[model samples]
Every structure is written in C-alpha cells, then in structure tokens.
Target: MTFPLLLIPGLNCTERAFVPLLGSLWPLASVTLVNHRRGDSMAAIAGAILAEAPPRFALLGFSMGGYIAFEMLRQAPERVERLCCLATMARPDTAEQAENRRRMIALAEQGRFDQVIGANFPNTVHPDNVDSLELRDLHASMARETGAETYVAQQRAILARPDSRPDLAGIRVPTSVVVGEADMVTGVDGAREIAGGVPGAELTVIAGAGHMVPLEQPDAVGEALAKWLRR
Candidate 1:
C-alpha cells in the first residue's frame, strides 16, 4: 500500500501555492496539504500539524515549510518515512531576517499588507518570471486567501523556529534537497549546506528558477520530487 505524503507550503501560502506540482505528483500517494493557521510559534504549529498528521508518511516542505519539516523530524522522527525540502534553508532567522519579519508585521498591521507582499513579489519570482501575468495572478490570489493576520503569524512562527543544522547530521531517512539556481532570498548555498549536512542526501538545482522554484518551474520541481519519492 502506498503510504500517505504530506506537503507543507511556504510563508503566506495556501493550498493553491502548490496546485501545479500537485497535479503531477498525485498518483504516487495519498497527498495531504498542511494548514497551519492556528499556531503562533514553531512548536505550536508543528504540534498542531502532527496532532492531525498520519501515523507514518513522507514529508515534503518548501521554504518556510522546510523549517517546519525540520521541527517535525525533531518532534517525531519515526513517523517520517522520507523527507524533502525545496528552495529552503535550515538556518535560524538571522538578526536581519528577524527584523525584516518584524517590519513586515508592522506594515501588515498598519493596513499596508498588500504593499508588504507587493514589495516582496520581485524577490518571490524568477527575474524572467516577474513579468508573467499568470504567475502574478496566482500569487496575488494565494496572498488574498492567506491574508494579513496569517502572514504575520507565519512570520512569528518562522522567527522563533529552531536552527536545524544540528538535526541534519542526525537524519537517518532518505533525504533530498532541491533549490533554484538563481534563488536570492535563501540562495543555493544554503541548499548545498543542507545536502552536505544530511547523510546520503541528494541535491538538485533547477536552472532559471528563483525563490519560488516550485511555482516558477513546476514541471521540473515535480520531476525532482518524483525521483526523491522513488528512492
């Protein structure tokens, strides 16, 4: 029997954040999308997820979801059959990153939430994809569905999340790390770092893609994930 698989989307993301890739990967298993609207801290968020998660499953995380994946491994190692992280890093929020989250939160609270996300649109897509109308519309729709308060809560959880460096070396399950070659927000360097630290992990870099690799290059991301799940 094919066991379940759980997909965790990035910050300010909704189920739609993964629609393109989801269609391609649906045949491999019973896939579930994680919803984390109730938790204010990483532990609380992770706990809430695990509370409703299957007893055993494969875990795939993207960006902020990767951090939550790390937390899940720490919280329930035996339950995860395989793990994959895409366009993600294991580093804890640096002072600069934390401050940026704070500023974003302040802006959201001040009713400049649209502006906050608008400013990030540049960094969110591949430079070439920045002008793509379909991608822009999809991102806008997802942002509206996620809304301001959830974004702020996600930022808070991310800011408090643990550094997963120490946890990486301890990973005993099959692991794969995928990143975009041109990702500036998290960078390929962090993906390399994650691959190096996790035992027997494989790394894949999607060319011409940026921070939103899965959305920017869905077919490639889906193929890579397919390979990861096969092993």
Candidate 2:
C-alpha cells in the first residue's frame, strides 16, 4: 500500500510551487499540495493539514512549510509514513530574524507588499537567478496569488515556531533532507544539521540551485523523492 504524499510550500507560495515537479512523478503516487495560507501559526497550520490528510502519509515540506512539518511530527508521529524537508532549518528564528519578520509584517499591513517581495527575492533564489526573468516572474506571480495578508500571517507563524532540533531524535520514520548548494537563505549547513539530528536520514545537495530547489531542479527532486518512497 503506497502512502499518499503531501507537498507543502514555502512562504507566499501555493500549489503552483509543485507544478515543476508534478510531471516527473505524477503516476507513481498521489500528490496533494496543502494550503499553507489558511493559518497563522505552525500549530494551526499543522493541525489543519493533519485534519484533512489521510490517516497516514508521506510529507515533503519547504522553508516555512518545513517548520509546520516539524510541528506535525510533534503532534502525531505515527501518522507520518515518511518525512522530507527541503531548504529549511530546525532552529527557531533568532531574535534578529524575528524582528525582521515583525518589520515585514508592518510593511505588509501598510500595503507595501511589493517591497517585501523585492527584499525577499534575493534570499529566495540563487544570486544568479536574481536576474533570471522567468524565475523572477514565476516568483512574483506566486506571491501575488498568496496576497499580502497571507504573507504577513506566514511570517508571524514562522517567527513563532519552536526550535525543532530536539524533536528530531525521536523521528523514527524514513527521512530526507535536501538543500541547494547556492541556497543562501537556508544553506546546506542547515540541511546537514537536520540530517545529523535524525539518525540515518538521507541528504541531497543540488548544485547551482537555491532556496527554491524543487522548482529549479524538479527532475532531481522528483527522483530523490521517488527513490525514498521506494525504500
């Protein structure tokens, strides 16, 4: 019995985030993209996903979605058949990062969302992709779909999430940690830290990619996911 697979997107993202990878593995498994825009906290978001998810499922999460995935593991470890976190960190936000989030929230409230998107783009993609018109346009379109209010809510939720490092040792399910070599936002070191905490977890690094590794290297990501599911 193959488990259902759920994909969770990062900040200001939607199902479109997985579009690049969908064609690569659609027939192998049932894939569902959870809406991360509904809730304002990790707990709320996790709870909502859990409530809608099948009794047991494999989960792949990116960035802010990774934070929510960790909360889901904490909430119900048994229901998860496998877990994968990409371009994410297990540590909670530092004071400075939290303050930055607050500032972004304020800016969003003032309807200056394009400012937030502009400021975030550098961290969201590889430095090379910063000038890539296609990547930039895709990101901008996704951000627009998410809206300013959703962005503010997600930022707050991420800022408030607990440190997930301690919870990792308890993870018995098969796990994978993937990161982009050029990911400045959540660097390879962060993915390494997560893999280290979870015994026997696999780690994959995609060269020439950034925080949005799945979008940039979907075929690589799809192959990694498919192999993990088979194991």
Candidate 3:
C-alpha cells in the first residue's frame, strides 16, 4: 500500500530544500512539506507536525529534520509507515557542538545572522560546490526565509535534543539511511551507525556530495528514496 510522503527540511531551511527532488518523488506518492520552524523544541515541533499530518506517512527527514523524525517516532511510531534519514546522526549534541551552536546563536542575536549563515554554508556541501554561486545563493535564500529569530530557536532545540541512537533498533518501519561520502557534518560513520542499528535498514552513500545531499545530489537521493518507497 502506498503512503503519503512527509518531507522535513533542515535547520534554517524551508520546503525549498527538497524542491529539487520533488519531480522524481511526486509520481511515487502524495507529498507533504512540513513546517518545522514553528517550535523551539523537538517534541513541540514533532507534535505540531503530527497534529497536522495525515494519519500515516512515509517520513523523510533531512539533516536537522532527521532529529525531528526521531522525536516523532518516539511520540507516535504507529503513524510512520517508513523512515528515511538524510545526512543526520542519531546522537545528541556534544559539548563542543553545543558550544558552537551557542556561538552561532549569539552571532545571530547580535544581528550577524547573514554572517553566521555564510560561514556555515561551506561546511554544508561538497568542496566542489563551495564556490558554486547558484548553490550558495539557494542556501542563503533558504536561510533568509528561515530568518534569524527562528535560527536561534532551531539551534537551541538542536542543542537540547536527546540521543536517538538508543531508539534506532526499536524502529519497525521500512527504513533507509542516506548520506554524502564527503559529509563532514554527519559523515558515513553516522549513517552506518543508524543503518546498523535499525534491523533490515538499507544505507546509501552518495559520492562527491556532503551534508546537503538533497541539494548537492538530488538525482542520486531521489533514486535512493524511490527504492525505499518501493520497498
């Protein structure tokens, strides 16, 4: 049976983050782009999405969205027909990572939001795409749409997020884990951890891409997701 697909975008991102892959996925099932920017906590965000979501859906969560997906599963596992996590880890924030987020939040609060987004852009994609003006502009535009206040709230939520690694094996849905080979933010190791933890979960590692796998390698991601959907 086919289930409606629910798409969740990452930090400082909107539905635009998944636009590139919609063409390939639209034919597979009904698609819903979720608004994850309304809440400052994962529970709140996931709860809000669940409240407005279809009774059941195939969930695809990108980067920070993956974290929310885990929370959603905790809150309502029966509603998720399948799961796909893209470029995100099942771990909680490390001390260093939390400190880094705090620093970015401080910068955004000080009216240097653009600077914060600009500095983080390079790490989000492959080295080859670092200088691609088109990708850079798209990233910047999405960040702008997300805005500074929401950025801070997202950072806070990310920092406070729980470790989801423990819950991985408990997931019973058809699951797939996708990541970029060169993803420094959430590398193959993280993907492997999730894939290994989840019974019968498949892992797809796209070469020459980074954390922004959906934007950096949409075709490959679409293909991988299509396979997951078919299963």
lDDT of 1: 0.88
lDDT of 2 at 176: 90
Model 1 lDDT tens row, 1-231: 566989998887887878888866787878999896768887888889999999999998888889888998999999999999888999877788789889999999999998887888888888899898888877777887899989988888888787899899999899989999889777899999999999999999998899989888889989998888788
lDDT of each: 0.88, 0.86, 0.92
Better of 1 and 3 by TM-score: 3
Instruction: List the candidate numbers ranked by lDDT, top first.
Output: 3, 1, 2
Candidate 3: tens digits of C-alpha lDDT, residues 27-122: 888999999988889999999999999998999999999999999999999999999999999988678878889999999999999999899999
List model 2 lDDT by residue over 9-38, tens digit each: 998887888898887656666889887777
Model 1 segments more than 4 A misplaced? none
Collision count for each candidate, in order: 0, 0, 0
| Higher-ranked by TM-score: 1 or 2 | 1
**lDDT over C-alpha atoms for residue 64 of model 3:** 94
In candidate 2, where is summed lDDT lowest over 10 consecutive residues? 21-30
**Candidate topping lDDT:** 3
Clashes of 2: 0
